[model samples]
Target: VERMESISRVNSSDHVAACQRSNVIISLIDEKLKYRDSRAKDFSAKCQGLKFLPFVTKPAGFSLNWKGNYFKMATMFSAAELYTVEHQDVVCLLKPILNENSPSFKGCGSISLAVKDFLGLIRKPTINLVLNQLKEVANYCEDITLYQENITNACYKFLLEAMTQNEANKVMITAELKDCSFILVENTYVDAAKVAFHLNFEAAPYIYPLPNKYKNNFRELFESVGVKRTFAVEDFAKVLESIRQDSESKQLTENNFQLCRRIISEGIWG
Candidate 1:
């Protein structure tokens, strides 16, 4: 009974803490302010006209890379992508965590969680879960080789298929696909939040910033994937915090510098 009570307390407090954090994110939005995209109606029309496959779903979890000049969206899709995850960037991130002797992360929650969450997506996979991750291998356009419209067109096709098609039709579309049609582009920043009210169906957005917003909601986004990154990111945060504390203490000695170097190197380079 004591153990059960302790478990219950942890769960209850975790729930409350999670709710408080969500409230902080939502509170940033003004209820009276809705995103108004002038081109949304026209964009929706163009989106509807794309030659989409039968069941390819709309892009969720959209990411922004402004310097790349092309916004990249992970075409999070069904298991059509089988042989690609190995070649993607997970190697650079996952390898260090899995290292058995790494003091920073050997038996850490981040390593276990990352293995549990990401390793299985490439191993045995499933599609029924909420926000199921598929692949990160997008054909990146270094320049404006593919016009912005083409990528957006694919997104619209995904939207239409996601909203309009039934399960049966979606299954049939897969059989009709000639190749991974997404070989043309990675993702586009179509502003899922800005155009939410204008989508054909009642679509819930994954990650897109509201228009005319004063600041980018970077902190809120970290919250979205906190479960996966909590272990890893917390370690990174601790290093920075240690450095700040050391600096404040006026202890800018060689020993402190070496400690910082070890923290940085052992955390990532191990």
Candidate 2:
């Protein structure tokens, strides 16, 4: 009996030691899982883009910069998305960035269209302000029903009819546009697609380093819009040079030069 008791005690000691090691391993695994979860959350937040803040009244100061192109591009994209949500007229606001001599060109002295769209003129609500106004619209137009009723313009009659479809359709659309109540406010002075285009173009140099799937999706956004899938600026001088060198060009008269120039310009710019 004495020998049996001693052996039992030894066995119990070994079992306790094994349990202690198991506990330690379990704690390490738990910590690793928690760290992985935290990292995932941080990456997700970064990818979701910037959240704009609402302003009660126009502030006395505003500024935006090109630091951290990823987040900056996301924030600008959010602003542009908000602008589109409001269904504002985009035609009058868009000016060709290549046309530097035009009076309406807003690039200051730089040729970068991204700079012009984001910086904008002092008088206009720039991209930063557009982001702020997105929040303002969210704050004021919380109730989609009431917001829809307030649409009084004759031109927006079709839009209103679309908004008031069957209950299920209305619910779906309201769910989509609920965050874009600012679309008709006439606040943005730049085209949303152009803003998206130039910003994406500027960020192109950095995009190759990203994962293949992410890079593909980032590029696909522009294609989903009517814009083509290229960020390259065609050289008009090169086109002219090619035309001059063409054998068929020798018979062309100078009177047709203006017409040819207009057609070539349309082919390139349009």
Candidate 3:
């Protein structure tokens, strides 16, 4: 009977906690919806005349480049930093005691309870959930690219079949003269059209006649498949600006040297 009563009490407490968690999540969602609605007008204005792909979705996570390395939003915060009481000092203080028999400790609640609550908060569907959504969007982009490539190849094969045997013979005699001409014209038109349509498009002024050694060096430097072939001066400036901003935000400056010293000192003493 005692065991049954204990189990029942435990179940009831769990049900209450679940209800509380549900309420908190619902409240957060409500606030998010209200904020979203308030920004709807501004968002719509910014999206004017933009024909967004119907299948592509916005990534939920913010992108960050740290020390010349790109990292996902969730991974930016270190595990130790995430559990540190400095970030959620109040929550650490208010967390319910996990066991009455535990020894007292400085800084926050019992170490085990603090760790548990920290992990729980991290696991919750907060802003980090947006990162998962972004990964899905990236996958969708890859799928679309593959589909487009297949369509392009199919169209090329269909056009190849349209030529007669006599025309094919003529093309072979002139080293595929008709095929070469068609390809050249199509490429020129597409390149011109792309430049006209896209403001960011900038064609290379001249194809560099690189020596074999130089070509090999270039290939060795940039062997990644998906890396962009070229970058504009403006793009380089933007990257520099991003690095400056990130450094400034992190206070990695002479003025913050003392702060770092203090942190190091604390670690040593602890």
Candidate 4:
């Protein structure tokens, strides 16, 4: 019985030591798994082109500093995904950025269109105030991680519509008097593809040509609207260019341009 008891004690000590060894192995495995996951996440983020704060990045093709080409020619794009919970927040976050030169934003078409729609709804100081407030909110959203979970396409569309409709009061067109001058400056000779993109026309999937029939009418339309016919004191081009320098002149030109765009978009002029 004494011998049996001694042997049992030795066996129990072996079992305890074996258990300690097993625990050490398990701990090593867990640590290795954690390290692997962290590496994978970093790799995924890099592959997705996730930047620090601003997600916008132009293509590598535009690296060459050529003077003649436009800055947005290479297409600086943003690929921000919005979540349902975060969609409204994201729209709210981006409103100020969207509002600034919105009609000219070649990056995000939806945001630009939404801003245009919002301005159509909300007019003057009130819209201007909200836009100003949006500027404050736009300063945030840096904490948002690129690969957010639970994001759906529907949520994104919903956010855009809601934010757009939120400010639905239209602006007042107080004055519409005699004549406003505008310049159709075409310094850079770009093809139809580039023109379609700059104008934000339906050039996706395929760039359909502007039908030779409409091409002649296009020139006639502008001429009918009236370009300055040569002035003695200031050159015709310089007079139009001068209007662009003043804030009021700038606004008037924009208003006229918008009316022209509307006529074309609505097919009313055609």
Candidate 5:
């Protein structure tokens, strides 16, 4: 019984030591994991194009003999190349570094503008591909939703404008400026009439007398003329709120779906 008791005590001591070692290992691993996660987050935040750095550096170079024009050209060319590849990661990275306050960001606006013009050259089919790629990058970055939205809107607008212009200038131009189309009246009819009377009695075209009551009604009349009416501020706010809610719901559904898929794949559902 004495020998048995001694052996049991030794075994218990070994178990305790093993547990302590296991805990130490786990703590070390947790620390390493946390450091890795922090580094990853930091990296994602700053991942912009590498080419802009040299141009920014040149102005501040020890020689102090840098040509701004050459720097601008180089940066513009780099931006054009990046834009062609639809490298939004580079663009996002470039934004903060090129800000007005940043020493290196001086020529950034020019580079950015060049990139924007380059993006204008992208065809419709390629625009969607670039947008999806940007979305994936934005999702991974997580905090760039505003940037993503801007990029998406810019791409969409560019495409819309390009398509509209192309259609308008087509060889078989079927586009018509239909009657009742909204026209911008610079001044009130009375003001226009007075100006006309001052300039030439008969040279001015007949100006319709706009009533004071009809000033507010002009917007309604404009709409009646086939001009697409935009939502009022309040209505637009509600529309945006609805869209936000829908997006949140969709994201939740996607997360749930992913979780279920993972569980099934691991045989946890069985």
Candidate 6:
């Protein structure tokens, strides 16, 4: 009877929390829709003949490179220095209390209630459930790339409308337009907050230097798997051949190929 009561209370609390989160998400969606509608109206008014180009559903050779020049919308605070988390100093203050090894700690040390609940939910085979939920939230968010792309497309449409036949031919090549396609370029700049996240949360714990002889081979092997590139078992075989005195592939079985790949991966991570 008591266990049932306790479970009922817990379920009730969860229901309330879930409702609150849903409400917040709904509110966000409403705001986003309102803002997007306003932007669309404004854009339509300015560029009456502009037609939006649909992006490829499955884009190939995608990569995020931080070293690039890109335009940014102006704001009161610098986007580069903007902090996503609020009240960061409070976390610093509670660090000592949260530290398990600290002498000041007296109570049973465990992960925060939120993190514990999250880890519990994720530990189950709930990846699809999690992804669907994330996708719902993601639908409300504006992709910055698409936003900039719309502006650029609108500008080009305006230019095309104003252009003389010869000028348009020189610029766009109307007859050869079917053959002309764009390679999507994604420009990115890592901000201070994201940099800190990468350093403190996402970085490898340790990195050992590669030997002088293997360093160049390792770089080549890594780059071989990059955009518009291919890497085969033979590529790594060449590396092995260079390393071995005999330069033979007698023991290079499927298992050995996997093992060699793992070794290369670990060396790269380190």
* Candidate maximizing lDDT: 5
Compared with the true structure, the alpha-carbon lDDT of candidate 2 equals 0.29
Model 5 poorest 10 in a row by lDDT: 195-204
Q: Tell me how far the alpha carbon of residue 262 in candidate 2 is from the true structure, in angstroms, after superposition.
A: 6.8
TM per candidate comes to: 0.17, 0.16, 0.14, 0.15, 0.21, 0.15
Best model per TM-score: 5
What's the residue-level lDDT of 188 in candidate 2?
A: 22
lDDT of 3 by residue, 39-60 (tens): 5344332222221101101123
- Winner by lDDT between candidate 5 and candidate 3: 5
Where model 5 places Cα greater than 4 Å from the true spot, the runs are 1-144, 167-270
Candidate 6: deviation at residue 60, Å?
37
Which has the better lDDT: candidate 1, or candidate 5? 5
Candidate 3, pairs of clashing residues: none
RMSD of each: 27.3, 25.7, 26.3, 22.4, 28.2, 23.6
Native-to-model Cα distance after best TM-score fit, residue 263 in candidate 1, in Å: 58
lDDT agreement with native, every candidate: 0.28, 0.29, 0.27, 0.27, 0.30, 0.26
Candidate 6 per-residue lDDT, tens place, 98-145, comes to 111111221112223332222121122122222222222223223435
Clashing pairs in 2: 86-183
Backbone atom clashes (below 3 Å) for every candidate:
1, 1, 0, 5, 2, 1
Q: Rank the candidates by lDDT, best first.
A: 5, 2, 1, 4, 3, 6
Checking candidate 5 for backbone clashes, the offending pairs are: 48-93, 98-105
lDDT of 2 by residue, 64-136 (tens): 1111222311111212223221233211122111112111221112223222233221122233332333333
Question: In lDDT terms, how accurate is model 5?
Answer: 0.30
Instruction: After superposing candidate 2 on the true structure, give the runs of residues whose Cα lies further than 4 Å from its correct spot.
Output: 1-57, 61-218, 230-270
Model 1 lDDT tens row, 1-270: 122123224334453332232223222221211354344344333322221101111123323222112211211111222212232222211111111112222111112322222222234222211011111112333343332333333332342344244655444333322122222222322211122111121111222222222112222221221212212434444555756675897767675566556545654343
Supply the TM-score for candidate 6: 0.15
